[model samples]
Target: MTTALAQRPPATAAYSPPSYGLVDRVAGLRHHSPGRLQLILTTLLTLGLLTGLVAGLTAHSASAGTADLGNRAQPLMVEAETVYSALADADTTAAQAFLAGGLEPAALTQRYDDDLARAGTALTNAARLVPDDSDAARAVAALSTGIARYSALVATARANNRQVLPLGASYLAAASQLNRETLQPKAQALFRLATDEISAGYDAARSSWWLILLLVLSVALGVALFWSQIYLSRTTHRTFNVPLVAATGLFAVLILAVGVLFANQRTHLDSAAQKGSAPVTALAQLRILVLTERADEALTLAAHGSADKEEDFERASGAIYFDDPRLAYAERFTTTLKDRHEAYLTIHGQVRKLDKSGDYDGAVALAIGEQATTTFGDLTTTLDQAIDNRKAAFTDEIGDAGDGLDLLSVLGPLLAIAACVLALLGIRARLEEYR
Candidate 1:
């Protein structure tokens, strides 16, 4: 204690723990038969485990995405479409009522009211699906705010019309302008977002990279199992190890089954996109265009500005006439929509002729007459049915896509573990003989 530093044992080398060189150890183990068997066991087990994990995870993800496609994405798009269509229909109906001088037709009034009600209900439903503070949410909010202002304008228009005031036409025109310019565009934007989500969802649900990875691992393990068998037969002069053989057979069967299921899911996903969402989108756009045309037709007469700036209507009609572009994407109700649309166009021509000939009252009668309403109603009903059919197709295909996925999610990993255990047992037996 008097001179601890001097008395202290001359500083020995600091205590150090042994450190292994992992690569060197691995190198030492790879040269002999028993060491090789151990390495093979480890490699095969790792591959099997990886394959199992990827397969299980991919199956679960695909199943969930497909379900969401059927449940959330498509339904939200349909709701947004309903909002757009209903708003345009309401505007068209309102314009028609305006054209009928005093005390508008009860039927027209009723239809107009129903259209607005439908729009409001659909907007609420859309709000449920859209995330808050997103573009879709903003659009929904804008639509909500605009509707009240639009309705007030319509009410003012109606009041003035009932009293034979010219200002009523201006108000009706303003309301229509607001709907066409502000509200319908927002609804369409919401719809476009929903459709874009569907497109991206299909790619995510496919999980193609995971499928390829699982496939590669499965094949590598299978080849390793084969090579191990061959090496054992050459080294031990034995034809087969029953456990290893059985394990190989099981692995093959699992791969085949999973491959079949993966193929089935991909097929269903493609069909859902093609026969369902694609058609649904094309038809929705066509229907929206038709509604716009109807609104413009009534607005044209009401405004009395005298020139046909119906470029939108012309483009829509040309697509209908050529049977190309929009209608080409969806086929079921093409004939019905086209026939009704053509009939309406012919009637619209007569309405325009009467107006140009100075038979203004007669033009108004034909424009809001039973013929026009029936034609429009027929086309609308048919389009609705077409959309419903496509939606059902989407749901059915998505349902098919999800089939067996849940079972595979659990079963795949279990089979992989079982095969790994069997292979390990066979290799360990060989190693024991050496010991």
Candidate 2:
């Protein structure tokens, strides 16, 4: 037996099993291994990446919204308004020139030419801005063709008038109808489309609720990590981990800064929509009304006692020179316009009476000569002043809105990257201490 035990490697150290207390087993179960630390680091880094991605996306979206509102939408809206105004003014000028007969004044002819040039330029600008297959694009193309046709008609009318032919009146009437019925409505539709796009941009800028929620969750994760660091300090009986603390501070500041920037951007956009776009649009509509009335007045004489033209003039004048309860504060400006317009209607009435009584020379003198000085001329001055005032208001409000959003896109992604770097450094430092 002794020889056998010696041969069995000295009996294997008495054969007693290792002892383990309950506390030791429980501790082993609870303790994190190196692999667990790696897992925790991976999870933290993933969260950091997610947060950064979300921040970058939100920043990009906001930046795009800002650009659309201030750069694309507002400018398009203004251009559309320009087109409408130019077309209306052109029709009115054409009518005024016709009333001057074959010997139209140099100033009146020059004004007509200027209006046509402005309309063409505005149409080209609008076409460049709109998408290729869009309704706005189609409208612009159609208007281009229509303008060519109307010009040809106007030229024919001028030639016939120089030869003392009554057919000039019929040509002028057809061109005016084309402007009133087709071109004006198309321009209005384009304006509406541009305004709709502006509204969409405003909505996009304001709608950041999902981004805000994601940021809140990211902040919560940061707080949890901070608390975990504190727990580790207590359990390990070591000083605080500085890097983790720094990461937490950086994350918090990022959230706060982003929140502030988003809030300010939203405020500025709202102000622009309300104070800038709204007032300018109202004034533009008012300008169209004035141009319509002027066209009606001239068309009445061009039609030579056509009751239809007289009725149209009266209807347009009523809309322009009356208080509209639906328009609210806009009524105040219209009140001033109304006073000037009433004076015009009085002279127009006298001119019509002279035409009906066979006093054709007197009617022509009042309609297009020095007698128009106190009536149509004064009305034109009033409309010009109103347009200038509204334009200034639009410029100031839109400019402020645009300036507020300058730094948001750059700062957002930068801060996100900083937070991610800080988090990785912090976790790596804590892991090194464990190793």
Q: Each model's TM-score, in the order given?
A: 0.88, 0.80
Which consecutive 10 residues in model 1 have the weakest lDDT in total? Answer: 11-20
lDDT at 186, model 2? 88
Which regions of candidate 2 fall more than 4 Å away from where they truly are? Answer: 1-40, 207-239, 321-338, 345-364, 371-382, 404-406
lDDT of each: 0.83, 0.70
Clashes of 2: 0
**Model 1: clashing residue pairs?**
none
Per-residue lDDT tens digits for candidate 1, residues 1-435, read 669766755445322222245666777888988888888888888888887778788788877777778777888889999999999999989888877777888988999899999989998998888877988889899999998899899999989988889898889889988998999898899999988888878877887777888878887888888898998888885799888898888788778878888789999998888888888888888788788778777877776655354666677566554264544546657877788888889998898889889898888789888898898889888888988888888889989988998888888888888888898898889999888
* Stretches of candidate 1 exceeding 4 Å from the true structure: 1-20, 131-133, 155-171, 306-309, 325-332
